[model samples]
Target: MTDRHDVVIVGGGLVGASLAIALVRQGVEVGLVEAAPAGQMPAVFDQRNLSFAAATVNALTALGVMQQLRTPTGPIRRIHISRQGDFGRVRLEAQDYGRATFGQVVVARDFGEALEARLDGLSGLTRYRPARFVGFAPDEAGHRALRIADAEGERTLHARLVVAADGTRSAVREALGIGVDEHDYGQTLFVARVRATQAPDGTAYERLGDDGPTALLPRGDRHWGVVHGVAREQAESVAALDDAAWLARLQRAVGWRIGRLVASGERSAYPIARVVAQRLVADRAVVLGNAAQTIHPIGAQGFNLGLRDALTLAEEIARGDDPGATSRLAAYAARRREDRERTLAFSDGLARLTANPSPLLKPVRSAGLVAMEAQPSLQAFLVGGAMGFRGDVPALCRGEAA
Candidate 1:
């Protein structure tokens, strides 16, 4: 006999695990399948810094995941954005919008561990670890039959709604023949932890140059999280630099805004790209997180956007009797349309404009920054986006019971 579940979420990463927890709270039977072993951590839970928007913080709090964090998180009181050779810069303060802080930055590993801890206590949830999703077949009873291979060997399962929370190269998505609009930016991002001469004062800096954007986000009381973008052609050399040499190169790229970089941690680099699925829903299956869309890391919108996807989809599932109903899935897609489009456009446009080397465009970029700082309306618009206030926010995101 095949095991049956109301919802079977593939890829037990941040988004997938969140969805499972949300559904289980709504009295829905959820089965979570993860490719990794029981004790192994997913790649998403790396040493990188994750900036959680206010909306995301609200949702996580409602889910009881925020309070469970064992690691410290740094508050983002203000954001300073500028171009290396530009005359103007923009500063956005959370106090201007009547908020304590715009967002909080947490180490990805810490956040992931928090989510995992919460998963263990959730009722009505089953976890299949060290499992691989072989394939799926359509069932006439409005469900999908899934095949899984794990340490215990092979088994069959059925799910009314199958969610793909896998990473960029989603196996479920590929099996369904979904295509993506992929754009390789020909740039690589180097991320690490660094100690600066000046102490972190709850401020985040985004310095854009001809090569790419370099961001320094407050990680804790003493260290700052660094994301340095390098051209693909020179990424290897930059990654090969010694700690002293790397610190020197980063100082040259970002200037003295954060003071000198004194110490650095292990550096990791990955190619940057913009990937959006051709479609979000198909039959009884739907995609979320990096599986549905992968945006540039310029504004730190990727994970926040994925969290919204999970929350919104969970809302839709909780409201209806049939979790796999086409109408519910359609509503999920419709609700995400506006937010997804705006975020993708903003991230992509920022990466292109800031990374452009044209001398003529420098003034244009600088003028835009100056205008944003001078105009309250423009600042509000951006602040809203940064806080994840776009479109029809779910009840959980609004700090309500869901």
Candidate 2:
């Protein structure tokens, strides 16, 4: 096997890249394996907008990752959530809770570019691009012998830990023999950048309808990031719509919240599903990000949760000399349990409950919304989660070193 590194991360996307940054900053030896070619962004880096929870912003800020962004991010100062044809609504202002803002929004493509720029500055890090993780086997040195493939051929690299940040359908996780409990939301999401007659005022809107939830998030470019969810059977029809027709449909769903949806930019669609790995750690290998849990995006919790995974794992690694020791991995799993479970349940439940139009559930749903509006404690609970302070938070989340 090749000379060992402290850790070898497969799937250098958002979570993996962040993990590499975190680990390297903490003085850990790191090898980053990315499937994309050199000088190119990964596939996950696209036009989709990522909502950075307060904690995420803090952690990335601590790593100096935010400074690398070429574009400014939109701050979420207020949030509005309401159901179509429903009697209740919930409005929250960060100022009401003594916070300046709940979070910020960054385009996935730009965020990816920023992550690349940040990663480049770390001269000690090893990057294997245009490469794929073939498989891993036990090493005599108590590490994993990873088979990595590139343009030349396959080569073996040993590492104390192997991370499957490979996303929802992780080949690394599968190679580790990890099974997942999966849920298909039966909903397809359409994403785009749109401009409204009235410019955004730093407020994000979630208009829930029987079809699904249509969200309008403030974007730094004075436009809005739109994520419109619809039933699977209707997805094709919506996908085939012309830009004008698409904006019209989006306008109908969003109502007058953001004013007229006058124009739209590039649009894309994909089905949403929840895939939770049954276990986080197996021997010297572990999963992070979507490999561990792929929750619905109704509340923009997916990436934030995955980022927490990276931060928590990084914290654990810093806590021990042997990064892949069984005791350390177990501790990492323990620290992640509460946050992971709560986030997964929150995202899955919110998506199902809000999109469900059953008359019986309507009153309960409305009552819950009303209570959230009237009860400060309840709203506190929500803002706390959205701000990334709910459970066992990593040091980076608290704006401290890991």
Candidate 3:
């Protein structure tokens, strides 16, 4: 069997789904493929919480997805960063920027459900659920022919463009003959939702030391999402501990930044790394989200970057550009250059710099933090960039109506 569309999107996760929404809003016909079955809304996927920047909120509002998010979205009015044994720290507050908050923290499940609801409400989207990509072929015309399989049999899908928003280990990226630069940081991120004795007060905290960087992000309730980086060997030991033992370890490692940790929800861990693709587009196909780049989860730039990718591509397609044209693809790559490079370098550099345990570097790091706190312009720039406003932002990110 065969199907046809103007655009075929692989991997119907947050990024792919968002891309589909954006394209559909632009009057583009979209075919979305996902390995997950229809009506299969998995359990909240552990206790992951997303920190959304103001720019992200603007983009989602433009996409009409924000209205569907269910939960008490907590605004991030302050960002506190410190080093365990350092003498200086950087404190960023929305008061300095004249904004309510740099961003908000949203539960993963709520965000997913909101996105899924938006997908469902989309009028011109064709979804291929529980379908896996078997292979792809790029023709001389710059169109891609994809082989996908489901319960019945294999089928061919032809589209002007094929987007691989699958994930870090993307099958579409592999089949497209694109290479990636992979870095294993030798660190694992332990994530969980914990009820803290202290109220969040709309603040996000990060403390760096020899073990690694640990962050506490505000959730809807009095709960805070805890992400602690540790050696791979120690991650398993930490994950296996009982509730009391885990709380004790968390308290000792995190100290009383948010006061005592009373209880914890589901706990999970992910290996940290910096994965960058050699190229963003290949022939008539391109990669998005983690398939294109995967950064350390330190600053929470992973999904924000992916969402930007989707928004950019959607804008390109909406501009009446030929989806399969080399010029159009090149333009998309050009538009993403500054933001992509800056984000990758910043995240990677911060991870490496903080992981250094040299006594000499500590003073330099502390001085840098102090400088950031003292300079308003510098703080605004950093905060703005962190909130997804770096480089040439799409109209949607500019708070313009979609």
Write down the worst ten-residue block by lDDT for model 1: 136-145
Tell me how many clashing residue pairs each candidate has.
Answer: 0, 0, 0
Q: Give the lDDT ranking, best first.
A: 1, 2, 3
Measured with C-alpha atoms, the lDDT of residue 381 in candidate 3 is 76
lDDT string for model 2 (278-332, tens) is 9999888889999999888988998899999999999889888989999999999
- Report the lDDT of model 3 for residue 83: 82
Error of 2 at 58 (Å): 0.5
Candidate 1 per-residue lDDT, tens place, 1-402, comes to 378999999999989998888888899999999987777888889999999999999999999899989877889999999988888999999998899989999998898889888998688998999898999855758788888888888888899999999889999998878999999999999999999999788899999988788999997647999999999999989988999999999999888988888999999898998889999998889999999999999999998999999999999998899999999999999999999999999999999999999999988998999999999999999999999998888888888887
| lDDT for 261 (candidate 3) | 90
Alpha carbon deviation, residue 318, candidate 1 (Å): 1.0
Note the Cα lDDT for every prediction shown: 0.91, 0.90, 0.85
> TM-scores, in order shown?
0.98, 0.98, 0.97
**Backbone steric clashes in candidate 2, count:** 0
Candidate 1 colliding pairs: none
Span of ten consecutive residues with least summed lDDT in model 3? 38-47
Q: 1-402, model 3: which lDDT tens digit per residue?
A: 888888999998878888999999888889999888877753433358888888888999888889998778878999999888887888988877778888989887788888898999677799988899999754535457999998888988899999998899999999988999999988988888888779888999988877678898988787888888888778889888999998888888778988889998878888887888999998888898999999998788988988999898888887765776777788899999999999898888888898888999998888888888888887877887789988878888888865
